[model samples]
Target: MKPTGTLPLRAGLGLKPEHYQNALDAAEKAAGGGLWFEVHPENYMIDGGPRLAWLDAIAERYPLSLHGVGLSLGGPEKPDEAHLARLKKLVDRYNPASVSEHVAWSRLGSTYFADLLPPPPTRQTLQTLGDHIARTQDYLGRQILVENPALYLSLQGDISMVQLYVEAAQMAGAGLLFDLNNIYVCAHNVGGSTQDWLEAVPADQVGEIHLAGYTAQDREGDEVLIDSHGAPISGAVWALYESFITDAGPKPTLIERDENIPPFDELMKEAGQANTIMDSVARDRQYG
Candidate 1:
């Protein structure tokens, strides 16, 4: 369900287990926190634990965005009922400011994969994706933003990935979680213009933006970019982020670092940088 509570038009960081106490302290220090925090939701799906308790404390002090990684919205199968029930409980418990899922599948029957695999962007796939998203929203009684996947290889399809992404969200009356690092990685790893993605995306549909870092690796004696959330935001992705907000206006941006997690202060530094960019855009809009 679409959350009635809203996040600040500033920056947020993905909350990690290591930084729970620090996040609580930070959230308590600032008013409305100016900064918000996101989580995988899957981590807190279990009942009555220290992790869930920590999240409860943080949610009370600051706005939370539940960025789910499961549910496999891009798959042919409908969302798992058990998963939806747990997610809905979280939604009801926290009343998060925003909720989101990905445009990739990670499950086949009872077996789950470690990676989020992208689906072909054909008409049939689009229909399945849209139906799944709609069903998820219906079950939760709120809308969700669907994130685009980081593609390693271009799949054959009738429509473009961008088209499939935007259309699926529109079909479900949902929002977009635009990930700048993913697109940057896609362009470098596969082939596409980041500008084309920017041009194709509707600014109004974008409820949140994600900024992260990618790593370069050797594969088959060639260079490939991996969407590794281990390092600081790259200059290229940061430039793309600035360009996006400058043109599309500001959205709730997130410094999404998951793997090789850094210190809380370092993540906050990235979030502060996002705020600086948003502030610049706001000032330009007022003065320009």
Candidate 2:
């Protein structure tokens, strides 16, 4: 993808309190030309608190990525107005270099599920998602990126993944936050090739790349990969990521670990692996 205005960011970590000081220290240290941090805006969706304080501190030193997990842009209903306003406040205060949300819908009627749920890819769903994204952008007064959700079950859907996502990006004037781990998980679960998905997606619309861990479950003796960002990235996923880096070129790659919280040093190490790979890819691109 050809990054238009913003200069591409390198590797970064999803911010956790355990690693906040480490992120601040890394921002100051510039070890390997520094690292960036992405955060779940929902965690900081408070009126006033230490979370904002920490965000301000780290954001001052490094480029921050505000990735939202709960926008529910693909719901059968319109996007929540209050949520949009709160998200806009965060965007205005931080002026984050990048902002993103998932493609999955989480809320049905008034009930909200904490986890992202799959949406049937119909034309109606795409229209709703596009409108929600556009409204979010209008409220935030800027462009946003839409992340591909990890799949669990194979559902009968009308539109293809790439087609719906590409159309949504185009209609909403948004970018794609490509998650390699999710692509692998979905492909493995739903019986498709990751390469085909990548090739079909409009590469220029991709703004960020995510690398996370997945768990393999033997569901009735059939292996299914779950997008559990709890542990270190797997070898196969990393190999696929490397292949994408070589072909698609580099973007702002992020190491995501949302569960099984670990020590600061360990999390930093996970982020460091992604950093090393992105840097190597950049150098290869430059020299080759």
Please tell me which predicted candidate would have the highest TM-score against the true structure.
1
Write down the TM-score for model 1. Answer: 0.97
Best by lDDT: 1
| lDDT score, candidate 1, position 247 | 91
Q: Can you give the lDDT of residue 199 in candidate 1?
A: 96
**Candidate 2 TM-score, true structure as reference:** 0.93
> Which regions of candidate 1 are displaced past 4 Å?
1-5
What lDDT would each prediction earn against the true structure?
0.89, 0.82
Name the lDDT of candidate 1.
0.89
Query: What's the TM-score of each model vs. the native?
Result: 0.97, 0.93
Candidate RMSDs in order: 1.3, 2.4
Instruction: Name the 10 consecutive residues with the lowest summed lDDT in model 2.
Output: 1-10
